[model samples]
Target: MQRLLDGIVKFRRDDFENHRDLFKSLKSEQKPHTLFITCSDSRVDPNLITKTLPGELFIIRNIANLVPPYRETPEYVSTTSAIEYAVLSLGVENIIVCGHSHCGGCAACLGPAERLNNMPHTKRWMELAIPVRDRILKEIAKDDIEARRWMMEQANVVEQLKHLMGYPYIYEKTISGQLMLSGWYYIIETGEVFIYDKNLGEFRLANG
Candidate 1:
């Protein structure tokens, strides 16, 4: 808390001054290129990882970075509505569904023991992850726990991307080639990022 407080003071004194022009430009308008949907993990800073500027990436961080299947139940949730606006109104060209290694939410989908069922809302939030379980189970041979966990992390990203397509605006844009969807996994330990290749059905490192 003390460090964050001091950092804010320093930003006001020095850091904000360094990027004054950038902030000034952003004050007028914002035209971000992508809708970056990622997990609300303390260690995962999207801008820091991508080296993007203030007006570059329009981000949505949530528990597990989960995209719930498009629903028209007459009740509005901010997450779903935000996704609609980012696609239809903002005209974002790319949508990135990023998941990371060691995701607690993804792992919880595997069992009741790990999931804190007492936390009803948290469990409900993780219900978005249910589809990924079947994929991981099908892919992992020998019933290996370690193998299942790793595959589940990557599969969760792909599953969320699939759910993104359930949104009408996003689906139409993607079909017409006006929008592109990317599934990505970030390995925090190695500082490595892997983009899922739909063609090869595997994740590969971004090449230099």
Candidate 2:
């Protein structure tokens, strides 16, 4: 708590002050170019990783960085709404669904059946992992927990990207070339980022 407060003080005194003009313009309005979605993992800092400024990347972070397929349910879901707005309203050109190494949520998804029994809501939510689970089971089934876990993490990103496209507005935008979607995997320890390259059939290092 103290560290965060001190950091806030430093930002107020140094960082914000040094960029007063940028902040002043942001005060009036914001027009971000991309919508970055990633895990709510503490170590993953979207702004820091992307080296983007305050009003550059609109972001959404969740437990597994999951984006549910487009639906109009009785309940209100904030993440879906954010995606809709980011695409149709903000006209954000790029949407990046990022998964990461050593994700607890991914590990849990790949683990025992008992894991989900305790948290029914989580169990239900993670049904979205079904496609990912099946893909991993068929292609790269491994006894090593760590290896299987990370494979599921990467596969989950691809699954979520498809879910994002399931959104009608997102699909239309993508088809018309008004929007571009990307899947990224961030490795925490090495500070290496791999971007899903559709043509290469591999995760390639992001150059810029």
The CA lDDT of each predicted structure is 0.86, 0.89
RMSD of 1: 1.7
Runs in model 1 with CA error above 4 Å?
Answer: 141-143
Backbone clashes for every candidate come to 0, 0
Best model number under TM-score: 2
lDDT of 2: 0.89
Q: List the residue pairs that clash in candidate 2.
A: none
Q: Residue by residue across 159-194, what tens digits does model 2's lDDT show?
A: 899898899888998999999999999999999999
Candidate 2 at 132: error in angstroms? 0.8
TM-score quality measure for candidate 1 = 0.93
Worst 10 residues of 1 by lDDT: 108-117
